[model samples]
Target: MLDIRPIGRSMLNKVPEVTLVFWLIKIMSTTVGETGADYLAVHVGLGTSVTGLLMITLLAAVLAIQLRMDRYVPWVYWLTVVLVSIVGTQITDALTDKLEISLYVSTAAFAIALAATFAIWFSVERTLSIHSIVTQRRELFYWAAILFTFALGTAAGDLATEALGLGFNVGVVAFTALIAAIAAAYALGANAVLTFWLAYILTRPLGASFGDLLSQAREYGGLGFGTIYTSLAFLTVIVALVAWLSFEADAGGKPEASPGA
Candidate 1:
């Protein structure tokens, strides 16, 4: 287990504490990512290509700001995450939709990419723990892993639903159960870092499945809430959560740093 402590009064960690709120916001951000990308691409008439470019540009700008920050800033960090989620979805969409790549191919490719990233990161840093993401290099690895997880999750979710005919709600239940099992294992002394990453990866697909369940048409297995409303509603909640975190930070409440880097 990681030791919850303030690393220093002067130097705060780069990532937020892994709390319930962190997971909540993460799931919500991913949901918004799926629907937001679709909203801009389809509803706004931007198309996938143009939306991809725009979102990538925005992600780059936000990531630059996040990298420049000295410590964890909730709004900036979550904004970068939201943008990354959107761009990640667009990346998989390009591969599968435009290039006509198979979901299985994309899923395998992304899994390999993520594994390579972890291998290189562990080789260079000697650790794959998120709690130790205090340097630029580790942060780079962290974000890269996050991007790949989103792409992989998008592909996996689509593979289960569209390819395997699992349907959106079923995918949600499946991923949710998997995550619960992981959590239970963690509680029973499984590797914390490994379990954390597994849960993180799983959350992407879980959230995406739920996003589709809400935004997709009833005929297509969703509840009939359009992409626009779903995206907006989730975005609103994300903003509120981030705002509260920012306020808490300003009030001298800092997230505890996990030990055992």
Candidate 2:
């Protein structure tokens, strides 16, 4: 009985705003990234390198699909995010566990990659706001930065837990505190772009730590529920949320312009 034409139009201009729902889902996805990667590498009997490679392949395919999309589809965009999160976690794990790379080096590499992506993105597109995703180059840079954030988050999380002996609980606390601080700055009228990006990067580690808390063994100071169960739970939530967002849109809907406008 309702008009249904607007849904397609809504997706063409920009992504959804940085709402609480967005942050909640983003954190959940990142948490799954940590646990899901570990499940494949450890429980599934695949070596870290193999698992990383497999995830990377899957990520590449998903990204290609995402790139070809003319506009944002809630399901398509979120699926890409979830896949990239898995791939990012694997990349950090491979570097640290398989190649014996130091966390510092991996973190630095990810930071550099993030910077380069931004540099190219801004140089080519002239704007990095999510509200202005009007071109392919901007989208490319967005995805690239997202990938690096997950990788950097993994490396930073591990470094805190392993190299510094901070433990998982502490790591979660630290990352959470940082995110809160960033949010406070944003509330105080700091640049939305800067605050949003800072919080975005930090959320990866915060979510990763929470995932470790939920899925790791009790001996390792976790609940030991295992990754499969955790991933399933999160995936269910993701599906439900995406479905709700899709159904709630007006006909010929347009995605709201993000606050970063």
Candidate 3:
């Protein structure tokens, strides 16, 4: 069996430290993912097929750079994540819109994919902790899991808000409550790794719900800000936060480096 213990102290892992800023940026990136994909597909007249291909290409390039890096580079890592989010959203959108698949079916499919990814990852690596993402194999698993989470989030969010008639605002509230409960459970001594992954998965839907709430038409239970404006605003915030993290890292106040597994 693969060893579960932390590895050498000097080796740097590719992922960032889990902190308040990390969560903040993660939510913002997810929101951008939702709105950005909509903007490109609808407003920009690219259609889901074209937009998906473009975003997937970009995500592939960015991920290649990220994988080649020796350590956690804030800008590269977050850019890859943002692109992944967009591509993941487009994936679900294509399945539901173009293929005419039901949101319920897509959600169940993505959930199964995520669960299988986790099971295989743990079976091979002996750990699912982000802190143990040292080997290239583990990093591949991590990215695969992240992609499925975003896709699952898109399907689940749409299923709740659109298919179930709960509306965007209600979906946001429901997901927010779930995340808060997860946080409470973690505080009460829930398994750290489990709680972390649960919260991570839930945040994608929460952020996507909020994205629709802000960007959809007023008649559609939203604020009517529209996708373009909402995407730009959230993208600005994401850029600012990533820049701050980069500045901090350059100032010799880098986040704690994860040891190799």
Candidate 4:
């Protein structure tokens, strides 16, 4: 059974700690996001509209559970992320594929929206730091920013790989390099919060490109692993990691408290 119970903790931050495992799972989740969305929409024959509606409904339910929680719960947090990824991908695909909007236009629009969200969030909270998510309002702002990031990432990724003709292999490498540069900057004393968000955004495209490399046919410069296998492989790893995190939390691990702005 899904445990929706809130755990005892001193702080109210509802996000996981920034760690290597966190990034590992995040990248894989994006991979699953790309492939999973494709599988359900195309291969499963639900079509994009039906897939989008189904995923949105599921995301609403999971997000409600997440909002009700008083503190971070690994499973809940990750589940919300996965659903958001799917919904985000669907949002981008709808605009680009159905509405026939230019990728450049969608990318810029999402970017402006994300910047506006951050501006409003910081104007109200005085902090754009994830470490300060101790209130419901801040958490809401965080999720809003996250949703935009995923959508922006999807549009940007598709623009680069498909529209720009970079292809999957080069897309993965370019995004990976960009993230590495960001990490190096952070290590050299850049703002932690900014670096974190930058990396988080890039990882989505990097993972998506990697997913395509594995799932697409060899003629398309991919390995032909197929969407089902690619999604399943990444999802298995995600589930195992979440299980471990939950076990540790249940064993009385006091997660890091929310830091002040």
Candidate 5:
């Protein structure tokens, strides 16, 4: 069994409480990740390589600030997440579009990488629960796992929707159904940690599909909203929610992290 110690959960925890709001931000961040990366690479003409470097540098700076903090600050934490989302998408895009690597190969490699991260994390800390990320080492492992999940999700999602010709609409429905099934399993007494990770991985692709559905041209089976409108709209909602969560935390209305079994 995985160890899930609840001892130092109060002020030491570095992550936010896993709740509906948390998932909402997560999904939308991923949507921004998908559309935002494309817009910068193609529309703004930075290309994936250059945009990746800038985003990676920005992510490193934000992560440094995040690490220096002792407790979870809503803006700082979510900013780190948003950066991670963009960087992750860039990483996968570089491999697929520039290097001409197959999505299947990239997807498999990221899966193995994520598994290895968890294996080492569990070995060193004896716990894989987000609730136990009260130390710098644990937080490092968590972030590594997160990066891989997003990269892997990008590859897998691209394989399904584009390579396999599922199109954006069907991809959205398929991934959403899969997430619903995972939720049902969790409700039926599945291990919380396992289900949490599963749902987390699935949401990346679900959000990507949804992003494409909104941002792509109508001829390509989308709503023709364009990347600018889609990204700006989602980012607006994300900002409002983060501010609200920050206020709630100030009011001592914090939510608890999810259970880890």
Candidate 6:
């Protein structure tokens, strides 16, 4: 029925090497993920556990299909990302809502999970380079880390807004500033891998806070746009970007690293 092959020494056809556009799209996607998850849970009348379970099931199936494919396809890659985004948002929501876990505790827990994931990933692959994600093991680690980032982002964002007494708009501004600072650091001799991962982690909270700012009601200190509107706007932008990239450039931009290098 389905081919379940392990990735090996062959070259990787990942969606794109990390670039400015890549980060832009990533933040947009994560924001959509946050809003979309909230929409499903609240607007659709599905509780957090139900929504999380449903999204996780769907993500699992999509990931299975993605893993089955021998090479990366843009649509497939983006779809997988979208699903993972929802599931990741659900994870944090479940912990915070259902379990009554504090934001700081969830943040610490997710941080530990992410760190453990990286340790195992590096120990197994002997390299944490995103360009080298040609192996099934590497891909698994990558996805796992991504899921953790979203959860960690949710917790971290909540901590900033709630625990730290910064409102949503202020949180967004703070995270935006942090991201800009990280970019500057990356430009000034910081390790590419380190900077890339650091930025990757930061973008999650940045996007999540922005999503809340756009989607939540004004009484909640947001713009009162609603989740559906926010999701639609972000999805539309994402689709446009994908379509443009498909026709204008290759699936992704120029290669970051050569195969087998």
Candidate 2's displacement at residue 131, Å, is 1.4
> What tens digits encode model 4's per-residue C-alpha lDDT throughout 106-182?
99999999999999999998888887777778888999999999999999999999999999999999999999999
In model 6, what lDDT does residue 183 have?
79
Clashing pairs in 4: none
The C-alpha lDDT values of all candidates are 0.90, 0.82, 0.88, 0.90, 0.90, 0.82
lDDT of 1 by residue, 85-129 (tens): 999999999999999999999999999999999999999989999
Model 5 Cα lDDT, one tens digit per residue, 37-129: 999998999999999999999999898888777778999999999999999999999999999999999999999999999999999999888
Q: Is candidate 1 or candidate 3 better by lDDT?
A: 1
Query: How big is the positional error of residue 223 in model 5, measured in Å on the Cα after superposition?
Result: 0.9
Residue ranges of candidate 5 with Cα displaced over 4 Å: 1-11, 253-258
Task: Tell me how far the alpha carbon of residue 43 in candidate 2 is from the true structure, in angstroms, after superposition.
Answer: 0.8
Q: State the displacement of the C-alpha of residue 73, model 6, in Å, after optimal TM-score superposition.
A: 1.3
Using Cα atoms with residue i matched to residue i, what is each candidate's TM-score against the true structure? 0.94, 0.91, 0.93, 0.94, 0.94, 0.93
Q: After superposition on all CA atoms, how large is the RMSD of candidate 5?
A: 4.7
User: Tell me, what's the RMSD of every candidate?
Assistant: 5.2, 5.2, 4.6, 3.4, 4.7, 2.4
Instruction: Please give the lDDT score for candidate 4.
Output: 0.90
Q: Which stretches of candidate 1 lie over 4 Å from their true place?
A: 1-11
Q: Model 4: residues >4 Å from true position, as ranges?
A: 1-11, 257-261
Q: What's the ranking of the predictions by lDDT, best on top?
A: 4, 5, 1, 3, 2, 6
Model 2 accuracy (lDDT, Cα): 0.82
